[model samples]
Target: MKNLVLTFLLTVITVGSVAAQEINWVTLEEALELQKKEPKKIMIDMYTVWCGPCKMLDKNTFQNKEVAAYVNENFYAVKFNAEGNDVVSFQGKEFTNPSYDPAKASRRNSSHQLSRYFQVNAYPTIVYLDENADLIAPIKGYQTPTQIELYLKMFANNDYKTLTTQDAFNEYYLAFKPEFKG
Candidate 1:
């Protein structure tokens, strides 16, 4: 029947949409293992379920094929929920959300200690780390697809190590594209 065919089509579309939204994320431990085997930088997307900008970044920036491909190729990308209950061990320390309250979901429980360890002050914070698991500064707030591309290229090419100051980075960034507004 026509109704049956329409229902099937809608189901398929819903499934496809959900699949597209799903990110291929690895845990911190898995990323560390990969880093140990090969020298690749790490990009941690520190997000919370209730954050709007974080959802936008996932739907827009991270979903972009170019951004996803570059991240997959150059770094061990880990999507970490700030309020998650799982145990995260980093730098010989175990980080966990010890005060999680399922009943009061509105107030997203305390962020894991790892969130503080990385100094994430806002939602949708992206923490970039070097090959040795050293902090390369946490890029706070939401970033557009193009903006993320710039950082990915800068860190991927090891430009961050050479540029000591923001002014120097801006100079180099401008030289690359003088008309760039951001």
Candidate 2:
């Protein structure tokens, strides 16, 4: 009886932990709508279907337990395909991929207007927006869990407000301690 009870308790704990570690990704429109009710900073994972580094980031960094938990808690995460057909409305404007070919959905298609709007010329750009849905920064390229953890914390904690100069940013970067194990 004691062993059975312990096993059931362990199973419940494990399931709950796994559930909590998941980053609840919502569509851009849904995120915007949710912000109207409960505001939070947004993090956009901008990527193309054919991008290799983007896949790596999704599999490695985004899947990391610490990365998933922090991003889930602090931001309304959006997985935006840069070259897909999804229409996103932002700042009183509607953006779409007019030239996106349906047959090449899994390959490289036309870039979405939102990607162009954010000037994302590369894959795996992490675009951060303030709680007011204003652009904070569009960081380009693939980042490890540890590398992204710093930016996540910086923006989440409003530490970016203090780093006005390049030197200040450098100092902040140098002093950042990464907690993401994966």
Best by lDDT: 2
lDDT of 1 at 20: 56
RMSD to the hidden true structure, all candidates: 4.4, 3.5
lDDT, candidate 2, 60-125, per-residue tens: 899888899899889999999999998778889989889989999989898899999888999999
Clashing pairs for predicted structure model 2, backbone only: none
The 10-residue segment of model 1 with minimum total lDDT is 173-182
Q: Please give the TM-score that candidate 1 achieves against the real structure.
A: 0.82
- TM-score per model over all chains: 0.82, 0.89
| TM-score of candidate 2 relative to the true fold | 0.89
lDDT (Cα, tens digit) per residue for candidate 1, span 23-89? 4579999999998899899999999878999999988888876677678889999999887777988
How does each model score on lDDT?
0.84, 0.92
